[model samples]
Target: MPTAYRLLLPLGLALLSACAHQPGSLAVHQQSQCPLSLRSGQQVILTLPSNPTTGFRWVLRDGASSLLDSLGPEVYSNPEDAGLIGSAGQSTWRFQARQAGAGHLLLTYQRPWETEVAPAKTFDCPLRVQ
Candidate 1:
């Protein structure tokens, strides 16, 4: 093998390794990435599209409390450039993998007062911590 080829091979491997998931945290944005695999003590950040101005709120149904612990309450943030009122934003929740187990993180988007109405949307993701 050429000397330059040998040198570049190691550099390529290093870059590939850096692209893997980080050790201490993982960010999830969509349900397609569900059935998450996490290491113990790793942080899980979940963000979903939301707009409370429409009278719909993301309510936590199952938080996977058996294997994960909530780090804080839901946080909502709107884009700074979208100066208009009632614009869509995002809702984020933070959690930490506490033990080796499997569970599901579930949430529904619905109006709090509309008990008779079904949720407009739902987010359910399976989680595995090891």
Candidate 2:
């Protein structure tokens, strides 16, 4: 094979792989770890630590984006020994990039019944779809 062809082939494959999701996926907890850009059809997951036993849950304050679509309903999971009682776990939200445009996601941690109280935590992720 030509040297140029070999070089280009690997580079192209790398770029394509970058657009695909990694195996055994998990949500990103830290906002700093969030990707600034993503390719169309790529999915982004945001995970936050939560303890629903206390009545506080992560809610989607603003996740509507023309460039993105919610993949499915939010999911929650608990660690091993789920029967241990009062154990904290995680909540996740997934979104798939639909087209080339800007995207926005906002999440707030609060109790749904407490309207007068402020959220305990918040996550905001802004993204660009390519």
Candidate 3:
């Protein structure tokens, strides 16, 4: 069915986007539209794009503290990690309305075996949930 194909398209694309890379050097050449906004009490899906197999992690942060961590769409085995980018070299994280405040997406990429955390970027995704 057309609807089923449409739904499966994203998943197929995600799998095709995965690429193995050296750890600690996972870098995003660029970032597209990020930090999507959603209404309070409403649920929405936000997709974070990344380079294939970059080991991207999606971290939801509420101010100074973290709310949750997720493993996105093309994460493979090998190195043990909590979060992995799904197929399509991107991960989709869900969001819900919370306390009418601001939240942030903290994306980090560091080399293997080192905690230096190089080439890290933070995106301000604001939602005035009311």
C-alpha TM-score for every candidate: 0.81, 0.74, 0.41
Query: How far is 104's C-alpha from truth in model 3 (Å)?
Result: 2.7
Off by over 4 Å in 1: 1-22
Winner of 1 and 3 under TM-score = 1
- Best-fitting candidate, measured by TM-score? 1
lDDT of 2 at 11: 100
Scored by CA lDDT, what does every candidate get? 0.93, 0.80, 0.44
Candidate 1, 72: how far from true, in Å? 0.7
TM-score: model 1 vs. ground truth: 0.81
Clashes of 3: 12
Candidate 2: 10-residue stretch with minimal lDDT: 19-28
